[model samples]
Target: MSICSYLWCLIISLSCVAPLSGNPAAVKEQISLKREKTITNIVNGVPTIDKKFFARINMPYRDKVCGGVVIDRWWVLTAARCVDHVSDHQYELRNVFIEIGNFTTGSQQKKTYKAKAIVIHPMYNLTTNSHDIALIKLVKRAPMFRVAELCSEPVEYGTEVGACGLGSTPARHPSPSASLHEIFLRGIFFSFASFFEIDFCPDDQVCTEPITDGASICNLDEGSPLYKLQCHSRAAECILGIASHFVASEHSEINCSGGSNFASVPHPYEWISETIVFDFLFNSGHLDRSF
Candidate 1:
């Protein structure tokens, strides 16, 4: 017999015998193990390692009251409502602090920075929750922390996204979670904003539904960054939006079960870039005070 023909016959014989020789229960167990390993990487209200771009916004006597993402060395992007103080006139600049590089709320290794300024969107409306975005200028540049890149592309319906924050969970009511938690959510078409008693523009907001039951962004999760993995790698996160508010549902008693909306990063991309440049110039005394 030829060498090629002999090898082909041997391969066919092994293929036929391998399945017969394999134990059914063992094969099933191996398949189950493989599935479990794959599911482990998918976020489902699980604790996450410390992310350099994740920012915890803390108020006086409160830890991680809101969440933010570092967009620049001295700037953090967040929801306008998180630091809104229209009546108080910039009170958050003094009271709010930014904590970075910490997974837990009270970690000693966390770096805290005082806020130099809190800039809310000019068109932000308290009644309708429109233009719900803001920026926080840090007192000094955040060192050793990576800046999250803002995503310009629109999130297509059914696309998977990730959200991370130190927010309230079922076990921790009336208080934020002690450690950072991440959950996977899918972009959805949410047209019934009025029915849910939430206001959002489809063009400027990204609506999402949780992939895992009982896993959602809850209280104190406002301003938490909604990101997508770049190149399917956990290390490369592209910020898509910031958590704005939860859509209340009359059918469900659970918080954030109905779904949530985020202020799209690309919607305010121009404003953000301009504001940063203007702030830098003004603070550096390059711009005329009279002008």
Candidate 2:
């Protein structure tokens, strides 16, 4: 793929942080504070390949909090924390909606369905961030838009992976309704585990960075799925990784947003396939699961 380079504007900071305590764990030696988890106020650089595919995500919060994938006719997969921000009842799954086949700004796509129920990853914990994932249930079966295909084989070192999202561009993020959109950004990473590590799992979570296409996903890029592209394969080239958190914040005195640091997703996505997430979909009846 050709790399598109864009100069990044200064990243505005998000001001919340989770305080960590020096505690001991059953299997750890030295304990450091884990990342305090939170969601961004807006999404930037949101993009989609097909409006129909795009139509499968783009949800409505109290006012469009974020985006996700409609894996099953009944399930929309998104970050567990993203759902939590707009929900008061951690135990209840109701009053959430999503739109697909549409862009953040202008559009042309199809309709999927409204969310009737929502479910977070059973293992996800806001405190430790054990599992940072979730599933949303649509009240009805969303029309079958093509779902992303996860790789059955492991990703090779230096294997090509692609990322797309309704996330913030380096210039604009957490944009309001007027600036909100779904734009696609090709992600390139600075390192790789599959190529670099000998004991890495070949599952879904293989990490890499842009070598030339230097644009990366920002705070709003949570739960954005990374894909590998090939000219021959019709299905997903492979699952690269989810848009997780920035590592620089852990060592730097600042955050990712430029405040002391920036926001990031904790775990990389290795098994967050639409099918894996679809199992938790509350009302999945209309969609096919032959995948």
Candidate 3:
């Protein structure tokens, strides 16, 4: 279906739902009514038909949610800032859970795994938003889900890519969508992203603009996978980057109007590989720790 038609259908479908007004009673009723149905619009995007490699990083204690990609049987990749609370002692690995193999955020059938460890890039700078990627170690292997392969080369400018996430549509709903949504974006040069107010786009980041009108990344989309299909097969998608942040001038704004930035997967491929391998060998007692 076309983007416009899809959006129209979403509007018609939600027209009957209770409006989330300032009335506490109305808000409570709306919440109660939709507790079992979280599926909503995706800022003009469409619902994803398949979500094999998609993952959701849930921090229930902090009431935070971020998107993730399953990279290995026991590892997932996401934005470092999503789990940065760990550095400040606000939360721990025990509080982080990775949910996979589900399209809806409210689905009770998805597989959940505890985070055994989280490795944030040593060079990650919260202030500058540089090196924003991180690796999460799952306590149990997630072999039932497909693992997304990191792109070996940088995505070319003007290349079309897909971004999937369970984020909010500020215009439609303030809450994250119950269902997964996918949007198509075209990569553009950092020079073209002048509206983002960034003096220069770092090499470690990939910049993309929405291909469809009104489509954009929203709140809770952080760390979501931005991928490209391999051989045009939806099932064979490769990870190109993870949703980093919106670099708009208004840093406080959650609506991504200018464009979105992603931490390039290829830029940190070496670190990711080394971290996974070293962690495996060290845990298996195959590597000597006393150097």
Candidate 4:
């Protein structure tokens, strides 16, 4: 997760204030979908559709719902934005429960895990989405869920990128239940994403769009992993970016039209792979004394 740089965060927090729901394309269109195995390989370079590539991170807040990528028995990747409020945490990764291996809301395929320690990027700035990545070291390793492999570069300009989450579609009024109704997401071709002037994707992130009219992100799906299609690779998943942004206007009109353009700050996993955090875990004996 990119740390919020003081300047970036301030600007983003202000972007939502002006609000842009008036644009018809920014609105969301609702369609009733029954649980169908998410169709993958529907777009180029994406892996097969046999299994879902995401996991749901349940949190206390309605809009701030977090997401996790199934890495292995002991790890999941999410955004530091989910826990940006932790100024005084010493592994204080709270409200970090993830339900993985499911297709629809309340799927039985879900497995719950507790974050043993959430290591937020040192440079993460919640305000600007700098280093907007985080790792939820699970108390117990997750099973069956395959960890999506991340791409090093911004997927080819017009690539088919996919996002999934037990996240919600916009609801102007809040639902009394905690369950988030997942949105029907597909491989969006980012062919024309500049009209909105939407800009949250930093060099560290990428989900702005050459696809999905207006090119936006969704509520609660924050911290969800982004993947590009890589059919030739045998890897179980093709992860391209991490979800991070705050641009949906929340205006009922936009939410109704079923269009919202947003972006996510991504962590070049190539960079993250060599960080001390990996070494800290390889030597598990250090957390108690290393810091």
Candidate 5:
């Protein structure tokens, strides 16, 4: 990708707030202080996702900033941008870990796993935000965490969906929430998005706006999952989209006050299935490869 393309990619990050400073020490200190203050406010009192199906993506150099959902005992699906770093080559992120079975960011009891490998969609383009999905392999299986089932059903316009993440709340804070926070968003059609001057990517992407006021995904975990509850059972949730970019409204450049786009997991169902299956077979010694 050209420098211009790369710059466009940065816009897709959790860029609702100012970008992190160059000094690693300063960034780390800021994260620590932010964690200390998170308990005082829970980001609009949004409840955290259940401990069983949620995961927090943390960097060794930075605090937890991204979110992911468990796909199986060994795999997680998140936005490619969350773990993407300019300094690293594709399919590799340094010192990335995920915390599972932990609801609070300050908790000491979460099961953390070092990432074994990372894979981004082969067709993912930074310029157009196409195929913005990524898969992560953990060094060990997290059998205790509940797996999220993939859904292939097409999403209709105006469907109510739920999104959760460790992202910060709008209007009140720039730091991420200490605990997971969730909000309900009603899906919107891509065509309608243009009328409101919102960025809507319908090709392999889904868009949503907050159902409540003063709620925007602004700086939430980049790879948080968007869920569609099963029609018959409230207990079951089908993974629909992986959070990618939050578009700022024309009036404000600092917040995703208008809407956000997620890479549609179901839209590229074949890619997701093939990627997961290939990894599974290779790891189990059923497939041979020369690398």
Candidate 6:
């Protein structure tokens, strides 16, 4: 196969951390603390390794919260709710930065980009959380970063997909994790017969439960990618959905374990394609001057 074809095939396959040195006593004490297992917010997830291409969406003040996947050299795919901070349904892209390559927040191995523009789906509805996908354009091309390929194949029930993010644990993470974490989720059937069900896992979404009984996405995990491993390639994975919201038992509580709803990429591939094309053209109009 040609280089371009191989690369595109890889694209269709969409697809951490740290410590210090010191005095003997102090070092032993630090190692002891590190070995101690704290309650994780993601339930049963584990930390991801290096070289994976994921996006950590942070606010102007460097507060990393939401998660995203790089889809192009200059564009990232994330949940619309992550960047839609305004309440009046207006387009107000916030001053946010995209952190790439660094699993841990402050690591020098990562690349940072100032978001040049935010594009939320025009038909997104906050009341019901429908059409929940969005794209962010970086100020410049991320040639060194790996980009995920957009996949339109339907996800089958019972397919196990992997999700990664910097979300905190239920006790409320003191701050975002230094490393990106991952969890395996299995596809499930969602019945939209009732109004309540429709409100949570609407027609346009896909429902998934953690492969482990207690695994779940916490407060800061919104917009993370839901992807499947490539059929024969360990290094390649395909993007199937974008984490939008979750559904837990009715209770006045935080960090409850439950299933999550993802904005189905296959269902709205056209919209995504059109939006990306329009944004690229709009932004690239001045490229020739620089070229």
**Which of the two, 1 or 2, has more lDDT?**
1
- Predicted candidate 5 versus true structure: per-residue lDDT over 1-291, tens digit per residue: 999989876664323222223353553332233222111011333756463678878775754367788988888888877665522332334478888886765766678887777777877776677788877778889874478888787455566677777766554566766777777666654443444344335557887655575455655557888888544332337888887776554444344454566788887888778877887767742211111
Please give, for residues 1-291, the per-residue lDDT of candidate 3 as tens digits. Answer: 999999988875444222222453543333233222111113567778576888989898888889999999988999988987764232477789998886865667688898877788888887767889988888899974568788867654556778888876443465777888888776643433333333435668887656675566766888998887543344435898988875332322334543667888888899889888888777842222111
| Preferred candidate (lDDT higher): 3 or 6 | 3
Order candidates by lDDT, high to low. 3, 1, 5, 6, 4, 2
Instruction: Please give the distance, in angstroms, between residue 183's alpha carbon in candidate 4 and its true position after superposition.
Output: 7.5
lDDT per residue (tens digit) for residues 135-203 in model 2: 666666766654544444433333434455655544343333332333322222223322323221222
- Per-candidate TM-score against the hidden true structure: 0.73, 0.55, 0.75, 0.60, 0.73, 0.71
Query: Which regions in candidate 5 have their CA more than 4 angstroms from the true location?
Result: 1-45, 49-51, 62-64, 86-94, 189-199, 231-236, 251-253, 284-291
Query: Candidate 6 at 95: error in angstroms?
Result: 2.0
* Pairs that clash in candidate 5: 167-220
Candidate 6: global Cα-lDDT? 0.64
List the pairs of residues colliding in candidate 3.
Answer: 38-178
Best by TM-score: 3
Among all candidates shown, the one with the greatest lDDT: 3
Clashes of 4: 48
On a 0 to 100 scale, what is the lDDT of residue 45 in model 5?
Answer: 33
Give lDDT tens digits, candidate 4, residues 1-291: 355686777665444222323352442121111111110001111222344547667655434456667654566777777765643344445555677665543447666776566567666776665677776666666664466555544433433445544433334332222332322233222322333333333355453321333223444556766665434332234566566653332333333212222233233464456443564557562232112
User: What TM-score quantifies how close candidate 2 is to the native fold?
Assistant: 0.55
Go through the candidates in order and give each one's C-alpha lDDT.
0.67, 0.41, 0.70, 0.46, 0.64, 0.64
